[model samples]
Target: MTVSVAALIVASPALAQEVQPVPAPEPSQVPLIRMAPAEDEQVEEPQDQGEDGEPASTELPPEPVVAIPQEWAPVPTTPEGRSAYGYYLAGRSALASGDTQQGAVLLQQANRLTPEQPRLREQAFTAAILAGDLKFAAGIVPDAPGVSPTITEAGQLIRGIETYLADGARKANRLLAERPVEMPHDRAATYAQVWIAAEAGDWNRALAAPPADFDPISTLVARSNRARLLEIRRRYEEAENEWKELTAHAVAGSLFRLGYGEFLERRRRGEEALALYTAAIQAGQAEPRIYLAQQRVMNKQRPPATLRYREGVAMSLRTAADQMVAQNANEFAAVYLRLSQQISPNAQTQAYIGQTLINGNLPGAGRAVLAEIPPSEGPLYANARAQRGMSFDKSGMNEEALAEFKLAAEAAPDDAPIVYALANMLIKMERFEEALEILNGPLLNTADQIYEVRFMRGAALEAVGRRAEAEAELNAALALQPNEPSALNYLGYLWVESGERVDEGIALIQRALAADPEDGHYLDSLGWGYFKSGKPEQALEPIEKAVAKEPANAEINDHLGDVYWALGRQKEAGFQWQRVLTLDVDDKRRAEVEAKLKDRLNQLPYDRVAPAVVPATQP
Candidate 1:
């Protein structure tokens, strides 16, 4: 059901002049079919039946999903079974057209009605697989008593993909071992095994021979997966050679192009990678897969296209004008944004452009671009606003950021991440009560959003000084995701701040550090934990690392100054406090640093301060 770029182009020529809408199918045509009658039920054959009273073989094959020269032959209404088959066709049509949610809903309804029909069940399994709901696919696949071996095997393949993605390598290996040595032409299954083996770190198995009659597409996938596995194992030479073999036959619209190009670029073969990425971009358009590939190319220095000026106006500049106010971009990301915009204008591109700007610390510009999109864009609009809010928060404009987060939450009430993000923003603004209300009212009320809601709710409660309630909520979160880093960091930081459970807090921070070694916040928390445990010297290294990673972080700098002072490095501590003042920190924190500096300087016994050494270059 995935629409390839080539297939889209082929379909495009016939769809020119105007975009026409198809008539809605009748309600009775929905995929719902009641289960067939029990086998013992008496039945009567019609006079038109063959000599043995069996249905005639005169019926033609169903129409292809694509448009064709001939009109579809009318199906007989008298046969309920045929009517159910037509519904399955309609469901596939909906799926192929990119209405996957609707298609799956319809297909589910169809399966319920025709539970005994093999073809209907097979169609359902295919629909589920394409939707990436492997668990659902597996459940239905095995229970489909009358389904064909082809479809069941296909479902097995989908399950393998799920296993690989979910990191269930041992189970995946077992499943692969059970397959026949002479595997059938089930490419989906073959690719699933390849993905499983590769992800499981089984490079040898991945590089082995593929099943019989492997299609060209599956061959490329298997080879690509094997190559990627090699790269992971640092067998770069072998991986590069495999990539070379795979690229020659890689599908024009496949996602593998991104992975392949990334590998080539990693190996320092920039020219080859750029060529592959360029080919990928030219091979597809509508799906935006090509645009992503092109964006990657532009990020790596070769512009996706040359910036051209016409009639005294730079086209790229004009595009930027239309888009930038809504989003911000760092140097590298900005390049990707401009190039992607040049090639295609889409919601995702716009969103990414906005995100790039925000992450680059341009809140005002990011908000401007985000605001240009109408609310009718729904989730995309909300996502854009969330990025803008994050930019605002990062730049210390907490009030404005909170407003944007609130709006985003309202716009996407069903999105757990959006709601959780708004909660965090509210907590940052010290509007903990408001955050709690949001979590309790809508986020917690929604069954699908419970875990995230509870986590954020705990954070909000902690911010509001409800320590007991916060601990309880955090405990609940631990039940859901035992080693969740956010919960660990938040609870551990809280304990460190309270000067209680210092050892336990340090242990928790260590656990979080193991999960995300480079996280500045967790590093800061660990440093503070050590400081509280009366180990100032031990705290210095992590605090310095934290400040280095997050150069503009006010709290970390303050903490570093505290640690230096505790260690009796008076001159160095004084310098850190002065540095904290020079940064654009909040007024309250700046006042505290200024007061500390004044108190420290007054207590110094030295007649005069040492002359500061100047650096040759300044940031």
Candidate 2:
């Protein structure tokens, strides 16, 4: 998602005209059945080197490792059982390939054929939930008896939600209250109680103050819910006061501003509502609904009123979903998001679901969710396409990523984020000239002054051996944003590596470190700067710290080896150099590392001098 600075300079004004609205793919056309390669099976491309010789792409954080079951028991061998087993395998394969819809269908078939098979039933349930087929998931609850506690709880939650959606609040509350012990610490369940009360027209109880023990988010949600209910009841003054109090917090999100704006619009305060809408948009809240309302207001059209009851329910679910995401309860979050979507189907809700899936590392599922947003929803469509590009990039489908970015850029030619994303991808692909052309041509006359574009330009300049221009661009970037860590780090490392302005380099690096104290790359640069300044001993601690923080980083490892050799720890240096060979270093760096491995201390570029011997007789 990191775009090159130069590439981001392009004025994509023509891009929107070039992009046409595209329809979502049919379920049958969606290529969800493609299986991702296993980690061992994946062939890692050599990381591109940046201007400072670091990896061009930011390294993705390691995914949490989960233990897979070591064995699978053989399926039944009877003719009917065998047939079911085949279907089950196909279903699992489909799921692995990201085709949740097909997977669910196939798994459902398998479950029906082998009604007694717990594994088949469980898988079918999982697939259905992942596909957002809650109805199907609800139907299979009966078949999941005596399964794992997690599965049982999931079934209960699904059934509970279905009952709530189908029956009235009374029936749903009765059903949910039966399993209070199961959700002892469940924030969602607690919020649901408030929502049910509000649904049943008990405004006083619904607005009742939460307990002291309630979490900050829960407390905020409670207040917001009460305000929303007040607005619904046309208590304008009370609602206005509540909204002002809620939005006064610096941490208040777009949702609060949106609610307040709606309230203002409803009360015939056009200008005030428009100001709030503009502020929300300026604050980078890109939800389609907000943009539509803003446009409507600008044109003196009436902003549409959403049903207050549905809004209340959606808001509660959204708050719970946010909590679930914070807890890393991805499935639970998905369920809440899906429920919200069912009630509102707003662009904000859809975007939240897609983003949540992406954050959870379910890019395939995330792309599916994003695709559901229609192109007619301009803001959401552009945002979704950009996100889809990111998903492709994360999945290692670079070409597809490029295409998606291009599509998004065309759709919103003036959108800096999309243009920057496209350019960044090009930089990652090492198409430096193309990236530079975009920056210099389309972006030359553009008025937006983004520091990221300058920094990326500097990187591209360095990549193409235009060091002076790169240095100038970097300086320009620093001038624009003095404390930008990437620029400070890059420029500092460049000077340090070239054995120029050692003290200034060290100072810049220190500034960067002050900004981001735990950045392993910055630490390595500081250590390297020390070594370059003929203070190998001073380099030792920082280098070791950097190595400790990023043990697998090839550059850090190599730098450590150099520091060790300078300190006369030849054997330790050798081990570190050998370790570099096992890492994913670029070809040029690998060659240099290999040379160092062969020659050890002799291959190092440091100016090592023996200590002078003084005659004792002089004293």
Candidate 3:
């Protein structure tokens, strides 16, 4: 199951005091997940990050893999089945390429030809919804046990929403009320009632009792929902009280802060909103979202909340999309997203739906959605451009990726996060001078810089051969955030490689390893530290284990070869060095690897591998 709405309305810090750690997932799911720098980990509400940034050495994770099927089932052999199979294959290809309109057409044709195949119909219905053909999807909606499309929840909800747009609220509420009052359907129906009643100008029913029990996640959303409705209904006191309770308890600088502050601004309480944003910033919530909110208020916004009933219903649909997308079957969220768009087209919704499609591996559909956003939506357009860069990177179109990032940076030059992101892509592409210039630029050269800025700048400096400067920057980063494992690993490895503070470097790497035992980079750093400290004997085991964990890593393999050679395993060392040449090493590393294989090798006396021994470096 997806934790959608819950992901959005996070339990406040106080509510989250008794946090339970999630259990580890299987290693198969971690197919190469990070970028070279911290900015790659952009926190988008909850899921914004470069999905294609990780090295293959990074152990694949299983969590985000969720329950998506990989291979398709075989099609039947009858005449209609074969024709439908061809159309299905073509439609799937079209969808993968981001041509949802044609894809939906082809998929619907396949379903028509293969009416008995439930899966085909499901695919067609999904494509139709994603293509914004809601009525068509609703007409052919399947009745499954889950939101994959049960009439009790998703199906009835979609149908009712369509009805409200066509036949009005009374008729829609009648249909919505008929859905089985089960767990999810009960909640969906309750939300539907409020929106429908609001449309009919019935405040009593609109502010009815809780959908079910008041769980933390639902309660937060429910309070937010009730407060918004209250304000819309001109019940000012109740709305203000509700906002107070939420602001007091919300996770610092969350979207709730944004929502509440926006509400205050619209109510002509600009000073109060400014105070809220200021408090959030002073409380160590320096996120751009809060800064943007403060900027909006200072510019003198208009007074009092004024939105039509349709707009209210559209906002509720956006909320429902957030909830549904958090589930494992996130593709279904597009149903709600498209429906919301049909009612009220906005850049925020388009960006969100676009991102959802991209993250869910529907890059074609995602790119198409993102492309539809007008450039007039300043920051939103810039973000969409960045996402396009990510999509390009994932597709191996490196030039296109960099170009898109450049466009984003140019468009939002003052947006610190976007600047950092462009620099990140440059660093990854070995365009270090360009990246260093950006890092050293005025926008990022502030005194109280975040750890990411410091660490990434250190990395860029190191790449451009500024040794002492890199170390000092990394030290500044370390001082800013002492327990950050990535910073520790990078600085430790830098020192180990340059023969500076080797012993202390070993300790730092050990700390990094302790923080994340499965990190291949940390393991390699530990082994390299041992070798640099003149104990190749101590280096063998961790290096070997590191190789096992990341067999495809050129650097780790090179380290293993050096360890093997020092221990009299000369033949194996030569084999390892030869293998490094075939892996994706840099040109400089390739030259060194070639020299090692040719001039420096003669087999030694050792005929077998030595027994493993634990290094003192183990934490």
Candidate 4:
């Protein structure tokens, strides 16, 4: 039931452009509300730029406004003594501008200066929620001065939002249970009940809440919540329909479409997914979740699309951009990344920018971006090291790439994922002994990584020609995850190669293909399944699909060559084998492909073929 790529790609672009953008106020206009200054002021003006060497004005700047005391607006401050008011204004401005770090800092300073200031305290509460620092928001919610019961109630509602974000609704619901009916924060109390019921897997309670009254901007939030609730209940068809409704009814400038787009992507509607994602990107609503989501979709496509949007953007912008990308619009992620870089200079962004460049088929550009961070010491350094290793490996510098992997492995010794990466890299270098040591030692001991360790151990053994050991390890992995596709394909393909249990191996590959219908590697496995069964003609379709999905995969291209040769298509077979030789295949495989190409060329008749060779396209 997979939708053809041709149908998805041909959809109208105008329909995609209809989703709304996220609303943002002009940069120069600061929303000002007053809070009274304490008699003892300990205000510290935010310095122009901190020692981190990032941009100073990338976040909110400080400003002054009128002071309010005892929950009422006080007289405006004189020019000479406005630092306290300035801190409050600056903090709120920072929060509104999506600069949570600066907002947090400024709000902290303002809270210290005016402990009894309700407006200042409320702003602090809002900042914590927006920053996703639930613990901080919880602390602030209990102790604020009641300056008008409504403001205090708003504070209480945020407390529920924080609790929901942190401990899920179970704890939040228990907390609300102790409150009396006359509690000052009923609205927040009601919302907490809704959140708790939904999180506790009770969709009926969540749906029973009064219809949400949201401003244009907040309406997006409401719709997203509704969509999530429906998704949680496993009402997928209904959820899809809700998303469709939201797409049509959501305001043109609303950010809710990111979530809807993601729903389409998860359903494997790639064309619709990509279109919605691109709309969000073009509307300047690129979020980090969107980028990651879109990347997942692209990875599942016939021809893998680049996932580099918002790679170097501010964390907030990156988050938003990722959300949009996740909704499936990876092509515009670059805009968010570049904008984040322009706003702030940080190693995290640099690493992302480099990775994005690599995904875009610009390994040289990736290296150039990474080179800017001389003597890398942070997360960006590790990221740059990984990218540099891939670049070196691609350029035929296996030893150099191994050194980089070693550095990355040493830097994050306890991280099982990094260990797996290093072990995989070692296998590629044909250093199977070293790979075996790493996987059998550290990776095996790590919790939750046992399956991956066992899988890699099998690969290492197979690379070193330890056939019996490889089979045992792969069999053990299958016992843990019976339908694990990588293990299934690898073990099945190995059996095919050895001409043992040919029918069983072919069935295994077909089952793997069913699980991951669009995966290029799995497609190649299925094609090889046909070849092993002596059905060369039957292998052609899957082989062609595999090549279409992963143009740069050396092994898939070689498999295609084998299929062509079996079909007596000598010219195409030679071209494919030559293409494999041009890629960064392992030394042994490279030599084998070269030998196969030469053997086939010699068998061709002198006058039957044209003199000039056809341009070879590799996997």
How do the predictions measure up, each by TM-score? 0.40, 0.67, 0.73, 0.40
Please give the range of 10 consecutive residues that has the lowest summed lDDT in model 2: 1-10
Which of the predicted structures, 3 or 4, would earn the higher lDDT when compared with the native? 3
Worst 10 residues of 3 by lDDT: 29-38
lDDT of model number 4: 0.60
Write the residue-wise lDDT of candidate 3 on 288-377 in tens digits: 777877877878756335556777677766665665554433454565677677777878888988887787677777888888877789
Model 1, C-alpha of 478: deviation from truth (Å): 2.7
lDDT for each residue of candidate 1 in 29-79, tens digit (9 for 90 to 100): 222112222235442312234889785565664333221112234532224
User: How much lDDT does each candidate structure score?
Assistant: 0.60, 0.71, 0.72, 0.60
- The positional error of residue 498 in candidate 4, measured at the CA in angstroms, is 1.4
What are the per-residue Cα lDDT tens digits for candidate 4 across 1-619?
Answer: 1111112122423423543332221223121112223446554322345578664654544344334553425533435555666777787676554355577677767666676655566666545433334456557752332233433443454454445455756665555555421222342244335546665655676655344442332233344455555665668887777667666753332244666766666566778887777777776656565676567666774423212111211333344334323333322233334434544557666666566555544455456566566554665566577677877788778887888777766766765666677787888777899888988785454555567777888988897889899998898888889898889998988888788877888877877887889999888888887887889899889989999999888999999999898888988998888778667688888778877866767633222447887889997
Backbone clashes counted, model 2? 8
Q: Which stretches of candidate 3 lie over 4 Å from their true place?
A: 1-85, 113-117, 143-152, 179-186, 201-207, 213-302, 324-329, 391-397, 482-485, 499-511, 514-518, 600-619
